[model samples]
Target: MTTVALVNTASIQERRDAGGMYHHRTNFDKYHPGYFGKVGMRHCHLKRNQSFCPTANLDKLWTLVSEQTRVNAAKDKTGAAPIIDVVLSGYYKVLGKGKLPEQPVTVKAKFFSRRAEEKIKGVGGAWVLVA
Candidate 1:
């Protein structure tokens, strides 16, 4: 029995040139032409549309409300007690880290922590989540 083996006869130079040609056309580019898409543009738009609000703590809210409003509970010695409205319009979130106010206050904010809600309710204060 006789056996024969076939081998590729292409020269090394020709193989190298072919390899170079194969890699000449590539999908990747050093400087991509259309790199930034609609998503990237949308990111820019979101950055522009972003709104920032100041944060406040429980104690800060008490002081802020006291400063902004003119209603005094002390003034009413015989009549109905005044209702202190703490409209934290520009505040984004109210934290429950500080001391709770002795007097019940109506807090209107965008967001509040769980502890803040509990403290507010515990002190007979009302919390309103505003848009």
Candidate 2:
């Protein structure tokens, strides 16, 4: 699996300019930090349409998995395929042209739009909070 380690703009530029060709270096980029100031860098792994940081909080990630799983289950039951979704830092948010069903869905993070939340709830969906 290829992992992309994102770093602060300035640090990445500096590393590039300094001819640091090694993919793994002793230095830690400000944007993405290494584990314990030692080995094991926290890189972003690309899975499906989601980008995941392996070292992030597992509780946060559990919520995304739950959401995606729920969506998949809904699709399967309704004979519709799961949609391409975007995930960031253990949060998954979908924005498309069509409206979503009003079913109860337990999401862990803060949603950005009330309209989106309401739309989801209106279709027999409840926007629940996951502990």
Q: What is the RMSD of candidate 2?
A: 19.8
Model 2 C-alpha lDDT versus the unseen true structure: 0.44
Q: Compared with the true structure, what per-residue lDDT tens digits does model 2 show for residues 7-122?
A: 69998787766633255434635444643345657667746544432222222323444576756657666644332222344454432224544334433333324655565546
TM-score of 1: 0.51
Q: Model 1 clash pairs? A: none
Task: Please provide TM-scores, in order, for all candidate models, with all chains considered together.
Answer: 0.51, 0.27
Model 2: how far is 87 from its true place, Å?
8.0
Each prediction's RMSD over C-alphas, in Å, is 15.3, 19.8
> How far out, in Å, is residue 35 in model 1?
19
Q: Write out the backbone clash pairs for model 2.
A: 102-123, 102-124, 102-125, 103-124, 103-125, 103-126, 104-125, 104-126
